[model samples]
Target: MRFIFKTDYDQDVRLAKHGGHVFWYGLLLLFLLASPWLLPEYWLAQLTFVLIYSVVGLGLMLLAGFTGLFSIGHAAFLGVGAYTQAVLSNMGWPFPLSLACAGLLSAAVGVVVGLPALRVKGIYLGIATLSFGFIVEEVLARWESVTGGNGGMHVKEPSIGAWKLDSGEEFYYLCLVVTVLSTLAIVNLLRSPTGRAFVAIRDSEISAQSMGIHLARYKTLSFALSAALAGLGGALYAHKIQFLSPDQFNIVQSIDLLLMVVIGGLGSVHGAFLGAIFLITMPQLIALGKDVLPPVIGQAPGLQAVVYGGVLIVFVLFEPMGLYGRWLKVRTFFSMFPFYRRGMFKRQKSFQKSDRLK
Candidate 1:
């Protein structure tokens, strides 16, 4: 009888630890919704950028975290989505429907790009995607009218019936909705068996193949789905920023997208969202630092970039699991504080004892 009570108590602790994440997510939602009214326009605009970046970051999460793809050219797909929206909307297609088409176009391209994944893995594949992103940018630049040449293309404001999303605050709400929806989609996908298969493939493609998972098909689909989500984010960004430059969707942005997933923590849906907000917010904070610094750092604009690079290096070297990983550890420690004596208990033992109740 006493053992049964212990098992139930441990199970309750484990459940609360996992369940608390939902509460934190809810709090974040309320904060994002209130930001436009609560923060200055500049700050609100940054937050809106975070929402857009989060969508792209989620795609990176799907590829790198779940599938272990290590892709750096994810933004090429973003450009594909944005350019499609720009060209179609300019051609007088209705805005809402065209956005959906943009996702399809990006997905189609992703399937083609994903073909190489059947043969290549690791850094070689990363370079291949990087090359693809460059090619896409070049095409956008050389294509003249479709992409408006190197001068770039201007995008129409997004509209729904009588409503136009012109104000940053209005756009903020749009981005917020997309961010929330994209994260939910990722969560649902991760919970599904297909998502589990992707994780399996990530860990061992050979084993997964032996276990009856179709390698080429799942690989292609994961790439397509990731690109489709990136495209969705890009389409929204095109509408929000009111302009589309091929330069904005180049390899640099792709690397930045990869960095977000890495810095946020791979394999974590919440990490993608958290990373986007941090990466977006960090630059603005750095800019503020430049203003306050006396002279040494201000003389060299490169210092900011250096600092950013250094931070990424540190995270990669010491905390490859990223900030979300650290957050998990902190939660674990605090949750065990009352019951654990100087951390003497084994992690698996604690976990196993708790699991017996379930």
Candidate 2:
């Protein structure tokens, strides 16, 4: 095993802690930059979707993973961004401005939702968010004048001043840039005091409060920031599909977003991208499997849902740490080789302070 002796406090917060991280991440960046040229148009489009979902995943991870907040209506925020983008784009607004507005509007809505979140936890918070999502969907459907209701609305191609991202390749680059920036922003946030407080709260709210962290302020901030990222992703999704529908952002979509964070691995940045890849690619994989299976099994309308639920159950029972956590274990196993232990990554249970006092 390799170990780095830290000589300064800055090393603890450095983006690239060691030379290996720099080299590997540098290579990964180069590969991503060259992917358009390497991949076919269809695959490139799918990759674009992956990047967009990755942005949303990062946001959800921040809220759900770091802050221990659960949202069942995240799709509502996504819809808010999508509709906002569609409306602004149709009115001939610049892409950057419209995108920014989408995120801001979503964040504002998140704050509204977060206010109620202060009074609830766990299942109640989820129900509140879920109800908020339903309300947003209804508003989108009933507000025909603006949202076009069930008929949906076409989204204009994104443009930066005179430059239009009309082609799949151009749009892919745009998504890539946005995803990278969002990842960096989330990473930096996690390194800051605010991020530490979020983690503290996640581990134990009472302890965080005792440490002088304002629970309400940080929780609301987490919700706003998370919603903003989801909105940004929604804006991109609007352009990618070029159409907006209320049903597209309903409860099903929120559940999928939740699955992405959970399966991708909570509390790790890499989990967002991994989960996005799973989100975008799993459908295709299922379609391929359908070709090999019996028609009754393959053609069932609920096959995908069944598979998703089963996989989630398996992950929750066997690997609660998520894909990133699994990856860490595998990597550690290989590194440790003959000396690896089965209990190395096992969870430890702890009693509450009150229990200890008893």
CA RMSD, predictions in order: 4.8, 3.6
Cα lDDT over the full model 2:
0.92
Number of the top TM-score candidate: 2
Compared with the true structure, model 2 gives a TM-score of: 0.96
Candidate 2 residue spans exceeding 4 A from truth: 347-358
Clashes of 1: 0
Estimated TM-score for each candidate: 0.88, 0.96
337: Cα error in model 2, Å: 1.4
Alpha carbon deviation, residue 107, candidate 1 (Å):
0.7
Worst 10 residues of 1 by lDDT: 349-358
* Candidate 2: Cα lDDT at 132: 99
Writing each residue's lDDT as its tens digit, candidate 2 over 1-358 gives 5679999999987899899999999999898899989999899899999999999999999999889999999999999999999999999999999999999999999999999879899999999999999999999999999999999999999999999999998999899999999999999998789998998888899999999999999999999999999999999999999999999999999999999999998888899899999999999999999999999999999999999999999999998878887887788789999998887655321433111100
**lDDT (0-100) at residue 64 of candidate 1?**
84
